[model samples]
Target: WYRQAPGGSLQWVSFISTDSSVKKSEPAMEGRALVSRDNSRSESSLSLRALGPRDSARYFCA
Candidate 1:
């Protein structure tokens, strides 16, 4: 999610899953706004996909 602060700067926020998925043991994950900086640095830029039930979770903005 993104919001404009009183000073007019934008802020982003988000979440990420740490555990591996059933599809790939070392899967590539992507997200919006807030990023899970906790994850390890990798060689390539990961593209994020919109989450459906197939992804097992949905991102919500208030």
Candidate 2:
């Protein structure tokens, strides 16, 4: 897990389960987005890069 601190840096928060099936549904982001999300069903992978400032926040799985 990670959080966007007030200074705009990613800070580790906690350990997340490595189990791929544990992720929650993706949320809506106006500008920032996840790529290869469809591969999640096959347990491939999803990546997020170049996230917008507004996309900064806490993230968790399950």
> Model 2: which residue pairs collide?
none
Q: Each candidate's root-mean-square deviation in Å?
A: 11.6, 7.5
User: Model 2: per-residue lDDT, tens digit, 4-47?
Assistant: 64667764433323553444323443133332224456443334
lDDT of 1 by residue, 1-62 (tens): 23344445543333334532211212234232223322356321223456444333332332
Candidate 1: residue 24 Cα off by (Å): 19
The best candidate in terms of lDDT: 2
TM-score of every candidate relative to the true structure: 0.21, 0.28
